[model samples]
Target: MVRQELVARQLAEQITEHFFHGNGAAEARPLRVLDVGCGQATQVVRLARAGHLVTGLDPDPVTLGAAQGAIGAEPQQVQQRISLLTGEGGDCGRWFGPGTFDVVLCHGVLMYMPEAEPMLASLARVLAPGGMLSVVVRNGDALAMRPGCAGDWGGAIEAFGTDRYTNRLGLPTRADRLEPLTRTLSEIVVPLRRWYGVRVFTDQTPDHVGPPVDGRQLAQLLDAEERAGRTDPYRAVAALLHLVGTRPG
Candidate 1:
C-alpha cells in the first residue's frame, strides 16, 4: 500500500532525526549503519545518498544480488557509499565487529522470524554506545482495522482475538504490540521512543483510491499521523509499530 510505504518513510526520517538531532551527534563518526535483512536495500541506498556509510545485510543471495544491482545503477558517489553483504540478522556479530555502527535498522524482518530475541540481541551488540536502533513491525492491534473497515466487524473481532491476519497474498502473518516489543529490547537496550505507524485512517484506504497522490499532501498526512501516533485514542489503530532504542553510552 502507498500509505504504508509513506508511513515507513516518515518513520525512517523520524529515526534519522532522533539520531542526528536528539543526540547532537555528528554523522561522520561511527557513521556506519547496518540494515539487517535489507532486501533490495532501498533504505540503505537512501542513507548512503545522504552521506552516511551504509551496509545492507541479507541472507538471501538473490536479494543481495538485486541490492548490488540497484547500487551499481546509482551515481558513482552514492554507489561508493554502500556495500551489500549476505548474512542472517542473528549472525551479525560474526561478520560485523561489535559496536561498529552508529545506527542499526531491522525493519519488516522480525515478523517472519520464529524468535525475535536473538535477532534483537545481535542488533544491540553491533550498535555503538549511544547509537540508535530502529525497528518496524506489524501492529498486533491493527489486525482489526481492515476487517472492521471492510464491514466485517465480527471477523475483525475474531481476527484480533486470534492475533493474526492474512495478507493480500493470502499468507498468514502475526503482529506484535508495543509492550512486549519494548520489554524484549529493554532486556538488551534502552528504548527512546515508541510510536504507531500507518495509523488506521491511512491503512484502510484501498490501493485503487486514484492516480498517484501528491507528495506534499502525503507529507502532510504523515506529519499528522506522526504526532498522533505517540498519543492515546489513535495509536491503537496503527498498522505498524515503530520503536527507537539506544545502546547505553
Candidate 2:
C-alpha cells in the first residue's frame, strides 16, 4: 500500500507540474500511457482510473491474465480505457512505433535485467517528444542499509562491494546506482527530470505484514515516508529509487 500509494501521488504531482501548468487544468485530456511489466496491473488500473489511455504489457501470460482480471472488475468506463499486450520491455520497440507513448512506466522491472542500459534504450525509443519515463529501481548505493538495519553485519559488508543481491523470494536480482542510471537515461535521450526515494524507513517491514489498520497511524507513516522520500540525504539512503525522465521535444 505504501509503495503503490506513494508512487501514484508522486506521479500525479509530476504530471500536473510538468504537463498541466498553464490553466491550472491539467486533466483537460487523457494522456497516452504504457505500463511495461505491469504485474497484476496495480499501476495500470490506477492510472486508467485517473483518466488515461493505458496499455499494459507483460511477458508472462499468467500475469497478463491477472491484470485482465483486475481490469475486468473495474467499471466499464475504466475497462474501456486499458489494453493489454503479452511481451517484454526489451521488445517494446519491436511492437510499437516510435513516439507511441506519452508516459511510459517501467517499474520493478529493471532489477531483473542483466543490463539496464539496453532495456532503457528500448523503452525510451517508444516515448513521444516530451514524454515521461518513470522507473523504479533498487538502490545499489545503499545496498548495505537493509542488511545493516536487520543487524546482519556480514551481509552488510558483502553488499558494499557489489550491485547484486538475493531478493526476499530468493531470486538473484540487480541494483542500480544513481549516477550510472542517470548517465544511461541521458545516453538514451530521456534525461532524468526528477527522482524520489521509496520505502525510506519502512523497508524492514516483512512482506507478509500489512500496513497499520489504524487510519491515523497509517497516514502518519505515509507522511514520514513521503517527506523522507522527497527530502535530501534521507532519500539518498532509501531502499528503492523512483526516477522520472522526459524525452526532449
Candidate 3:
C-alpha cells in the first residue's frame, strides 16, 4: 500500500494548496469535497482532518461499513465532518444538486468502468462552478511497460494493440490514454488543469514489495518517485495517470 499512500499524500497536498492558499474567490478554504468510490474513506478522513467537509460514497455496503468504522475511530469533531453513503459513480446527480461540492475526487475507480465519458459527465454536473475534479486511471499508453519489463514478451506484444489487460486482482480491466481523456474533459466542459504520472518505475514491482524499513531510504525513494512522476519522458509511460480538471465558474 506504499504506492497508494504516496498517491494519496501527493493529491492531498495539491488539493490543500489549490483550495486553501489563494485569496481569490476561486480559492476557498474549508471547501466541500465528494469522494466517489471512496474505499475505506482513506482520503475522506485525511481531508476532513484538514477541516474540509467531506462526503464519501461507495457502492459496496461492506466498504462503507469499514469507512464508517474508520470515521468512528477519529475524534468526534472529525467524525462529525464526514458523511457516508452507498452509491455508484453515476449516482452523483441523484444524490446532490449542481454546484454541491468544490472538489470532486474519483480515484482508482475508473479502471473498472466500461466507459468513462458518461461517468465524467455525471461527475462534472455535480461539481460547483470553479471546482476541481480529480481522476486516477490505469495508463493505456503504457500497458506494455509492465509486461515488457517483466520479460513477458508475448503479453507486451499484445498490450501494444489493446487497452484491455488483467489487473493485479486477476480481473480484466480497461485503461485510458492521456490525449483521449484530455479531449473528453474538454468536451464535457471541465478542461484539463494539470496531470501527473504515478508509479512510473515501480509498476512491475511485486505487490508484496513495500517501503524500505529505514526512514532515510524511504524518504529518498519517495523523493525520486515524486520527481519522476512529474518529470518529462519518464512520466509518459507511468502505470497510472492522475489528472485534474477545473470547471469554469
Candidate 4:
C-alpha cells in the first residue's frame, strides 16, 4: 500500500507538471496510457477512473483476468475507458505502433528480468513524443537495506555489490542501480527527467502486516514516507527506485 500510494502520487505530479500545465485537472484532456506488466491493473484502473484511455497489457492471462474482474466492478464509465490485453513488456511492439501512448508504465516488472535495457527499449518505442515513461524496480544500490534492517548480516553483506536476490516470494530476481539505468534510458532516447525513492521507511515492514487501520496513523505513515522519498540522503537508500523519463518531443 505504501509503495503503491507513493508511486501513484509521484507519477501524478509528473504527469500533471508536464501535460496538464500543473493544475492536474484529469478531465481537462484524456490521454492514451499504456500499462505494461500491469499486474492486477492497480494503475491501469486508477488512470482509467481519472478519465484517461488506458490499455493494460500483461503476459499472464490469469493476472489479466483478475484485473479484468476488478475493472468489471468499476462504474460503467470507468470500465469503458479501460482495455485489457494479453502481452509482455517486449511484446508491446506486437500490439501497438510507435508513438502510440502518451504515458507508459512498467512498474515492479523489471526485477523479473536479468537486464533492463531490452525491456526498457521496447516500452520506450511505444511512447509518443513528450510522453512519460515511468519505471519502478528494486534498488540495486540499496539491495542490502532490507536484510540489514532485518538483522540478516550474511544476507545483507551478500546483497552488496550485486543486484541479484531472491524476492519475498522466493523468486530469484535482479535489481537496478540508478546510474546504469539512467544511462540506459539515455541510450534509448527517453532521457531521465525525475526520479524518486519508494518505500523509503516502510520497506522493512513485513509483507503480511496490513496497513495501519487508524486513519491518522496511516496518514502520518504516508506523510513520513512521502517526505523521505523526496529528500536526498534518505531517498538514496530507499528499497525501491521510481524513475520517470520523457521521450524527446
Candidate 5:
C-alpha cells in the first residue's frame, strides 16, 4: 500500500502540473478521463472526487465490484461523475469513440501483455488532441536492480539481456524499455512529454517495512524519492517508469 501510494501521489502531481495547471480551457472545464485496467479503482475514485469525469474499466468483476464500492462512499455527485465497466485494456477503442477522453491512464497494465502495441494503439485512439496519456510499467533497463541488490547475482545478470522477468507473484512477466516505448508512443501519435522513475531507492526495501511514522521523517523520505525519480542517473536505474505522453493534432 505504501509503495502504491507513492506512485499514485506522484502521478497526481504530474497530471496536475502538465494537464490542469496552466491550460486555460482545462482549468475552466471538467476534463474527461479514462482509466484502463483500473484495478480496485482507488485512483479512479480519487480523480472523480477531484471533479473530473472519469470512466474506469477492468476485466475482473471482483475488482470492478471493489471499485464500485469505493465510488459508493463518495457524494452522489461524485459518484455520478464516475463510471465503471468490466472490460480489458485492449477493448478501450471499441468501448469509446476516438478523441473521447482528455486524459487516459493505463498504469501497471502493459506489463501483463506479451505484445503491448495493440493496447497502446487503442489507448491513443481514445485520447483527444493535446490529451495526456499516462503509463506506468516495470523498467526493463533497471530490471536487475532489485535482484542484484538482494544478492541474486545470477538472476540479475540474466535480466540484462532480456525484457522477461518473474514478478513478486512468481509469474513470468514483461518489462518495457524507455527508448522502445518512446518510439511506440511516437508511432501511435502520442509523443513522450515527461517521465519519472518510481521506487528509485526503495525498490530493494522489504515491503514489510512501512513508511516512517513520524511526519518529518516521512516527508524527508518522500522528498528524496521524488527528487531521485526526476533526476538523471538516479532515475536511469529505477525499478519502474512513469511516463506521460501527449497526443498532438
Candidate 6:
C-alpha cells in the first residue's frame, strides 16, 4: 500500500536522523549496521548512502541477489559501504561478534517468528554498548482502528479478541502494544524510548485514495503523519509501532 511504503520510508529517515544526531558525525563512521531479513535491501541501500558500513542478512538468496543488484548500481562509494550475507534471522550470534554494530534494524520480520525472545537477545548481544535497536511491528492496538473506521464495530470487536490479525493474503499477523514490547526490552536490561505509530491516518483511507499525487504533497503528508505519530491519540491508531532501545555501555 502507498501508506505502508510511506511509513517504511519515514521510519528509515527517523532512524538515520537519530543515528547521526547521537554520533555527532558529518558522515557516520565506524558504523556497522545490520538489517535482519532485509528483503531486497532497500534499507541496506539507504544506510550505505548515509556512509554507514551496512550488512544485509536474509535467508533467501534470490532476495539477497536482488538487493545486491539494487545497491550495485549506486555510486561506487556507496557500493563499497555495503556487504550482503545470507542467513536465517537467528544466526546473528554466529556471524557477528559481540558488540559489533552501532545499529541493528529488525523491522517487519519479528511477526513471522514463533518466538521473538531469541532474536531480541541476539540483537542485544550484537549491538555495541550505547548502540540502538530499531524495531517496527504491527500495532496490536490498531486491530480495531481499521474495522471501527469502516463502521464494522462488530468485526473490530471480534478481531480485537484474538492475538493477531489476518491479511488479504490470508497470512496471520500479530501486533504488539508499546508497553509489552518495551517491557520485553526491560527483561533483557535494555532501555526503551517511546514508541511511534506508523500510518495512523493513512491506514484508514482507501488503498487507492486517489491517482498518484504531487511528489511534494506526498512528502509533506508523510512528514505530517510522522510528526503526529510521535504523539498521543494519533499514535494509538497506527498500523505499525516503532520502538527504539539502546544497549548499555
Kindly indicate the candidate among 2 and 4 with the higher TM-score: 4
After superposition on all C-alphas, the RMSD of every candidate to the true structure, in Å, is 3.0, 1.2, 2.3, 1.0, 2.1, 2.8
List of clashing residue pairs for candidate 3: none
Local distance difference test, per candidate? 0.76, 0.92, 0.87, 0.92, 0.86, 0.77
Candidate 3 per-residue lDDT, tens place, 1-249, comes to: 656666776676667566665353346468899999999998899889878899999999999999999899999999989999889989898999999999999998888999889999999999988888999999999999999999999999999968899999899999999999999999989999888889986776788777788999888877887888889998899899999888988
Model 5 residue runs over 4 Å out of place are: 21-28
Score every model by TM-score: 0.84, 0.97, 0.93, 0.98, 0.92, 0.87
Error of model 4, residue 140, in angstroms? 0.4
Superposed by TM-score, candidate 4 places the C-alpha of residue 123 at a distance from the truth, in angstroms, of: 0.9
Residue-level lDDT of model 1, residues 118-155, one tens digit each, is: 78988888899888888888887678778888899898
Instruction: List, residue by residue over 72-114, the lDDT tens digit for candidate 2.
Output: 9999999999999999999987899999999999999999999
Using lDDT as the measure, name the better of candidate 1 and candidate 6. 6
lDDT tens digits by residue: candidate 6, 1-249: 454455456555555566566454455555788889888888788778767898899999999889989987899999999998989768888998988888888988888776567788888888888787888888777788778888998879987756577764569877677777888898876678547777777776664466247889877777777787878898877888878787777
Query: Which segments of model 3 are wrong by more than 4 Å?
Result: 22-28
Per-residue alpha-carbon lDDT of candidate 4 for residues 1-249, written as tens digits (9 for 90 to 100): 788889999998998988888876833599999999998998988899888999998899999989999999999999999999887889888889999999999999999986999999999889999999999999999999999999999999999899899999999999999999999999999999999999988888889998899999999999999899989999989999999999888
Report backbone clashes per prediction. Answer: 0, 0, 0, 0, 0, 0
Compared to the true structure, candidate 3 yields what TM-score?
A: 0.93
Which model scores highest in TM-score? 4
Off by over 4 Å in 4: none
lDDT of 3 at 117: 96
Q: For model 4, give the 10-residue run with minimal summed lDDT.
A: 19-28
Ordering by lDDT: 2, 4, 3, 5, 6, 1
Estimate candidate 5's alpha-carbon lDDT, on a 0 to 1 scale: 0.86
Clashing pairs in model 5, backbone N/Cα/C closer than 3 A: none
